[model samples]
Target chain A: NAGVTQTPKFRILKIGQSMTLQCTQDMNHNYMYWYRQDPGMGLKLIYYSVGAGITDKGEVPNGYNVSRSTTEDFPLRLELAAPSQTSVYFCASSSLAVYFTDTQYFGPGTRLTVL
Target chain B: GESVGLHLPTLSVQEGDNSIINCAYSNSASDYFIWYKQESGKGPQFIIDIRSNMDKRQGQRVTVLLNKTVKHLSLQIAATQPGDSAVYFCAEGPIDHGSSNTGKLIFGQGTTLQVKP
Candidate 1:
């Protein structure tokens, strides 16, 4: 089913520069999430969406923003990039029926380096 | 703040041997726990999960054991293969109500498993 897909496999941005990381899922999942993984560390939630037109901030949402205009798309926007934002960004999805404990299918990830 | 931590940063084992990875969580209210395997340059993938109601759950050659008494979580892999070499992370989630009920998970630092043939 191609599970989850993310574009711009790798990107590098200068300070204050902005870019969007695109994510798409064809599993018809009702929930979508964005997470960042630092070197030698686990992932930290950035933002998430319950469904179309519904989005909320996650653990580390200070430098990022997100919007869910459709069920298959959830894009993370960096308004003013900073060095702290340089990390591997991953997009994941899960079904609403089993969102509590279901497996969150992840994309290959978009590695962003902010210099 | 709740956190999940791995006991070891790296584990080396023979290909035919069994491997055990340990994790400790600070939140007693956490009901759901998951184990994820991440290969280099790739995102984390779910290996298995267990709820607070159960102490042990088995899947194929892997098994997850949860101990609420001491707040410990362990993942056991039998007859590990070279393909099993990856970073393993233990995540705690769905801790009670409110913000945690939103289905968020707190991941551990992760343990790198190296299987030697």
Candidate 2:
């Protein structure tokens, strides 16, 4: 089902540069999320959307922004990129039926290096 | 803030041996837990999950045990295989304070498991 797919497997951005990481899911999931994983660290939530037209900040959303204009797409935008934003970005989606313990399916991930 | 942490940063075991990965969570309110395995250069994959209502749950060759009293969770992999070599992360999902099930997951630092044949 290509469950979830992300673009630009890897990227390197210069300081102050801006870029968008694209994510798409065909599972018809209502929930989508963006997370960043640092070396030797767990993933930190960047942003998430409950459904189309709904978006909210997560644990580490300072350098990023997101929008959910459609149910199948959730893109993360990094503005004025900094070195601190260098990390592996992952996109995940899950259904709301099993809301109590929804199992999140993740994409391959986008490796970003801000220099 | 609430956090989930692993007991060990790395674990090495024989291919045929069983492996147990431990995790400790600070939030007593957390009711749902999950274990994920991430291979090199790949995103994390779901391995198993357990709810606060059940102390133990078993999957194919893996089992998850949750101890709410001590706020501890463990994942046991039987006959660990080379394919099992990866970073294991434990995530906790606290009960949704709001109306909807946002499914906010708090992940642990992760444990790198090495299976030697």
Candidate 3:
């Protein structure tokens, strides 16, 4: 299975440019998440969706937005990208079966560089 | 904000040795925990998990120990090898109710492990 897939393995953006990081999962998971990993810092949640059309903001939601138009896709949008937004972004999905104990499968990740 | 931070930033161990990475969490309400490994250019992959009810869980060559009373968690990798070199992260899930029933996870700053031959 492809588990989870993210497009544009690498990207670069100017200070004010905007772009969307596409994410998809063939696992048919109910929970999808977007997270960013900075240097020594671990993954920080950017946004998440419980199901199609249901999205919620996470710990580091500033300068970012997300949409879950379909079960197989949850794309993260960066607006007016700042150097602070330069980080490796990952997409994940889970069954949401037993609350927080479910295992999350991750995508390869997209490295974004903003100057 | 509630967060998880590692006790060490880096660790080096010889092959065939055991490695232990520790983490301290700020929130006691976190009942679920997970350990993830990330290679240089890859996303964090789930290794194992332990819940508050259980103090320990073992998988393949890794074991996770949780001390809820102290808000401490550790991941032990046995017979460490060069293939095990990567950044390890521990994550805690908040056990909140209402609109946050989803129980999102909070990740710690990772510990980089380097294994030598």
Candidate 4:
């Protein structure tokens, strides 16, 4: 079973460009999250969805949006991409709330570079 | 503002030796703690976790120790190996069963583990 999968493994975006980073999970987890890992930094939460049709912003969500229409997919949209947005994005899924201290399985991540 | 931080930025150990990584948290109300390991070009993988209710938890060859009184957390690897070389992160969050809670995790700057053969 492919636990968590992310598309567009690598991408380069010009300034002001837009793109969607796709994520999918075969585990059917109710909890999905989008996190960005900057160079030499821990993962920072950008957005999260507890279940289908529900989404919320996390620590750094200024330039990103997320939609969770189905339990298997959660895509992160980058609008007017900037160099600050250039970072590896990782998608994760878990059965229980991370606030409950549940383990999260992560995707292979998408390397994004904005110039 | 909640924050998690590691005591050491890098830890080098000889193969077959034991390794210990230390972390601290600023949130007293944080009830959950977790450790993740990331390789060169991969996502962070769940290594182990602990709750405020427990002092220690073990899995395979790894152990997580939580000290709520001092807001300290540690990850112990029984035997270091080349494959164990990676960046390790400690994350903290509070207990929130509410639907509105987004389950945010405050992560620390990771500690790079370098294992020597």
- The lDDT per prediction is 0.92, 0.94, 0.90, 0.92
Tens digit of lDDT per residue, candidate 1, span A15-40?
Answer: 99999999999999878999999999
Q: Which stretches of candidate 3 lie over 4 Å from their true place?
A: A98-100, B95-99
Candidate 2 residue A67 C-alpha distance from true site, Å: 0.6
Given candidate 4, what's the lDDT at residue B103?
60
TM-scores of the models, in the order given: 0.95, 0.97, 0.95, 0.96
Q: Indicate the residue-level lDDT of A56 in model 3.
A: 92
**Alpha carbon deviation, residue A54, candidate 4 (Å):** 0.8
Error of 4 at B20 (Å): 0.5
lDDT of 3 by residue, B7-105 (tens): 999999999999999999989888889999999888889899998889999999999999878889999999999999999999888655554566578
Cα lDDT of model 3 by residue, A1-113, tens digit: 88899999999999999999999999999889999988778888889888999999988999999999899999999999999999999999988654444778899999999
Q: Which ten residues in a row have the lowest lDDT in candidate 1 chain A?
A: A94-103
List the RMSD of every prediction in angstroms. 1.8, 1.1, 1.5, 1.5
Q: By lDDT, is 1 or 2 better?
A: 2
Q: Write the per-residue lDDT of candidate 4 for residues B1-117, one digit (tens) a residue.
A: 678999999999999999999999999988889999999988888898898999999998999999888999999999888999999999987778665555667889999999999
Interface RMSD of 4: 2.4
Best by DockQ: 2
Highest lDDT against the true fold, candidate: 2
